[model samples]
Target: MTITKKTVIVTGAGGGMGRATVEHLLEAGANVVGCDLNIAALAELEENPRFKAMKADLLNEAAVQHIFAQTKSEFGSIDGLANVHGIAQHATPIEDCSLAEYRKIIDVNMTSIFLTCREAAAYMKEQGSGKIVNIGSVSTTRPRPGLQAYVASKGAVESFTKALALELAPYQVNANVLHPGPADTSMLGEFTAVGSSVDDTKKEVFESSVPLGKLLQPEDIAKSVKYLLSDAAEMITGAVLHVDGGRNI
Candidate 1:
């Protein structure tokens, strides 16, 4: 799938999956505008002429709006969006999970996408075509214990993306969800239970859950993102594409 001359906005571009997606899109000749709170991580891609790094808080409405505006101003048009910014829920039973913690996860994982997608939809509607790929989690299908908050947020992402697909189809804008399995990113360690050993949980719990017997790499998810954002997936809106290694089965 090729995205030559396309302008795509990638949120959480500082993170493992987001960075990989930005790189892949850049390699495909897309004008990539990467946004993340951690500007330092985005700096790594500054050397690429096709890549533009914007440090912005996804949760902030103004920042999100500014990202879309700046991206359009820079690239002349917005062709696609990859909503990859999200946070993992720490393993905690419902009784121990605070309302604040739950809302934080929802805000980051779900609400941020809402803000970004809304902005992109406006721009794309005017342009008459666009593609949007929201990153979800395999846990939305194969739920694990103590991830209630995270799973709920991902579930919302899937539903929301589907809704967008239907709403935007007439406008020629496509929306879809990409559910990745347990990825071997630095954030993986943050999902460990309070009293659990991070290493042990990774090996015995996370890794073992994937039938493929290994963690999904960042590039694996990136490849799927590339397809979803390309012309090859033009008819793939309202779909949930799982990049998981049989984990949902």
Candidate 2:
């Protein structure tokens, strides 16, 4: 499926999955605007004529609005939004987790998507057509201990995406969520419990949990995003696509 002239905005563009999605979209001949807190990582993508890299804190409402406004002004229309920006919570029991830590995870993972989706929905509704793909965690379905905050945040994302899908269907806009398994990304280290060995956790826990016997790569999730954003998935909305190496099963 070719999205030759489509315009898509991807958050967390500097990170692994985000970068892969941006690259894949560019390869498909789409105009892509990628935003992330780490602007330096987006430099290589800037060399592409069809790619625009923006440095913005997604939690800031003003910054989120600015990105969407700039995209509309530059591209004249927004065809899709891929909410790939999110944070993981370190493994800790709910009682031991601090309020600040919990709130931060919720804000980054859930609220950020809300901000972007709200803006995208308004634009898409006006145009009467659009696509939205939100990145959720496989943990939502297969819970891991000591990750209460993180799991809860992703659960909110799944529910919110479904609500958006139903509400926006009349306008021909589609909303869906992608639940990824244990992805082998830098962020994987961040999910380990305090003082736990990241490498050991990867081998003994994460990798072992996947029935496929390997962790997911960034491109694995990107390919799924490509299909969801393409015409091939026009009938798929409010669906949770688990690209998780059978982890959900």
Candidate 3:
């Protein structure tokens, strides 16, 4: 847990889990740059000396590069990256899922990671040290029906992170994936099938599916992200850490 004074960039900083991670890292004394397409949710953190909110789209190449460049210019170095931004797929069969819809999900979920990781790797590799934690989903392991596209995207994240770990090992940059299961976020309700009751699906389908019988809190995922970014996990690379409450079992 030695992240004090480190500079970490967190994507999706406006969302439930992302916001939590930003808070946790700031509390741990890390200089945090929170990026999101819309950063209205992070307004309260604007006054914090250790926090910076950047409104940028991860899908844009220039925007991604700017995030890293600005981080370096302001913080002097980038020590860690937490790829907490992502999208959920509505439960829809592949046959009914338009290719356009599939591409959007893949672009946002997988491609965005590519953009950020690629930019981070450049600076990190040069510095000879860094940590990368990409937030995936337990759905890759225990996918529910009609979430084929989402599963595929997250599965790609796991593989990509492993590849990154091996390629960047020589440079002392560690890469890993954190797959969360059935988090109690607004994003969870988005996974419900069309015309289905969101509350019922959360209780009957998502909550009950977890062996722990409780939905995961965003804080649960944030703490793990902190560990993966800290000195304690320096030797950990290419690992899939599940914060899923046994949902993947």
Candidate 4:
């Protein structure tokens, strides 16, 4: 848990899991840059000296560059990165899933990780050390029906992270993926079929699908992200951590 004074970049910092990670890191005494498309949700932390809220679309290459440059200038180094921003695909038959819909999911969920990780690698390589934790989904391992695009996107995340781990290993930079199962975030409801009751789906489908019989909380993921970014996990890389309450089992 020795993350004091480290500088970390957290994408999707406005979302449920992202905000929780930001808060957890700040509590651990790290200088945090919380980036998202809309950072209004993080306004409450504007007063915290350790937190910097940056609003930028990760798909834009220029904006992504600025996020890293500004982080380096402000924090002096890019020590860790937690990519938590992602989109969920609604349960839809392949016949109804258009190319546009599938591409959008891939761009948001996978391309964004590419952009951020590219920036992180450049900085972390120069510094000779860093950590990267990409947030994947448990669905990649145990996918539900009608979620082909979502599963494919997250599957790519896990593979990409493992490749990054090996590439950065020489520089002492660790890269890993975290797959959360049936989280209790707003994104959970987005996975329901069109016209399906969100609550019923959560209780009967998503919740019951887990062996632990409970949905994961945002804080649960935040804790794991913090550990991955901390010295406690210094030797860990190319690992897929399942924080999904036995859902993958």
Candidate 5:
């Protein structure tokens, strides 16, 4: 199947998984608009004619709505969306976690995706086709004590994808999630143990988690998302594509 030029919106595109997804989607010949709260990171892509980066806080529903409005104005319509923006905890123990922190994760990781899908689905329904790709975690089904908010948010993401898929199926709008093992991102370094500055030990732990004995890369996750947005996955929806080197299995 051939996938032609399409309009795609990638959230959290300032960097990390969002950065990787946009790169792959653009490489696949899609025009991209990325929403990110980091203005500088968003500005870095200003040189690309096919890539437009908007600095907006997805955690704010109004900001999410405005971002999509601008997205539609930029390109007549959006054909795909990659929900790669999410946040992890600061490694505080469960008892030490604050209500504020929990709310922050829920708003950014869960609520933001809901707003994106809701607004995107409206546009896609009119176009009669669209793709939604969400970034989920292996921790949804697995346990990670210090990451309570993150885990809960991902669990919601899985359910949200499923529910949205069933509702959009008649309109040919597909929603799916991708769960990836640990990868090297700026956020990863921040979420590491207190002692070490580098990510060697962190990488080692993730590599050890999977039978593959290596940490998965952003490109690895991007590849799976690319497939889901391609015509190859035309018949697929509500699938939680696992790109964790068999670790989540």
Candidate 6:
């Protein structure tokens, strides 16, 4: 089966990769539901009849619940969900990290995912099948400095995806993690920039580390997320698909 005619929800729909994923999903003829804290970006997507926009903070269970309610109310049932909402750290050493700040990151990046999965799983369980493509990062598998909270949360995302897949597999609800390399995303400005300026120094290091010798683009990630959500990946559950340009190699 193709993605066309299916209904999908994308979190963090306001940003770079999130917007790209929404666009690709639309092109595939899927009914798309986009949610973001940025009301303006969500408004832009509402212009398309195939696209529905909802303002939500995934960290808020009520807000996320409303997103599902809106989707069900408007598009019937959801066929897929892409958990893409996340934030980057400013390279604060773990030694300097605050408990409150760490908790906030975990809440935003990990707890919110659990909330979405909880709601989506219920809907998909009733439908008997669905796809969940969660976005993780290479940092989860690879060591990165001064980003303890973000990295730990991403690692949890990877772990949670596997655990959820195990629980959802009996019903054919596929769950998987997409680990991206250092992509050219807005998040990278902090990871790759140097000494009070946006520099290529970090990018260079990342580029040299990757076997592909380059930074990944948002489209690369979008394409992978699309395919994972499609029927092509029907049998691929609980697997961590790496889109990090051979960085793990």
The list of candidate 1 runs beyond 4 A from truth reads none
Candidate 3 local distance difference test against the native: 0.96
Each candidate: RMSD: 0.8, 0.7, 0.5, 0.5, 1.8, 1.5
> Per-residue alpha-carbon lDDT of model 5 for 192-230, expressed as tens digits?
545655557565655677777777788898888888888
TM-score: model 3 vs. ground truth: 0.99
Error of 4 at 120 (Å): 0.3
Model 2, span 1-249: residue lDDT tens: 768889999999999999999999999999999999997888877888789999999999999999999999998889999999899888898899999989999999999999999999999999999999999999999999999999999999999999999999999999999999999999999889999999999999999999999999999999999999999999999999999999999
For 26-60, candidate 6 gives per-residue lDDT tens digits of 99999999888885766766778999878888988
Worst 10-residue lDDT window for candidate 6 reads 192-201
Model 5 CA lDDT for position 39: 49
lDDT per residue, candidate 4, 1-249, as tens digits? 699999999999999999999999999999999999989999999899888999999999999999999999988999999999999999999999999999999999999999999999999999999999999999999999999999999999999999999999999999999999999999999999999999999999999988999999999999999999999999999999999999999
Sliding window of 10 residues with minimal summed lDDT for model 2: 39-48
State how far residue 119 of model 6 sits from its true place (Å). Answer: 0.3
TM-scores for all candidates? 0.98, 0.99, 0.99, 0.99, 0.93, 0.95
Report the C-alpha displacement of residue 51, candidate 3, in angstroms: 0.5
Model 5, C-alpha of 21: deviation from truth (Å): 1.3
- Cα RMSD for predicted model 6: 1.5
- For model 2, the superposed segments whose C-alpha errors exceed 4 Å read none
For model 5, the superposed segments whose C-alpha errors exceed 4 Å read 42-44, 193-200
> Which lDDT tens digits does candidate 3 get at residues 3-110?
999999999999999999999999999999999998999999999999999999999999999999999999999999999999988999789999999999999999
Supply the global lDDT for candidate 2. 0.95
Which 10 consecutive residues of model 1 have the lowest summed lDDT? 39-48
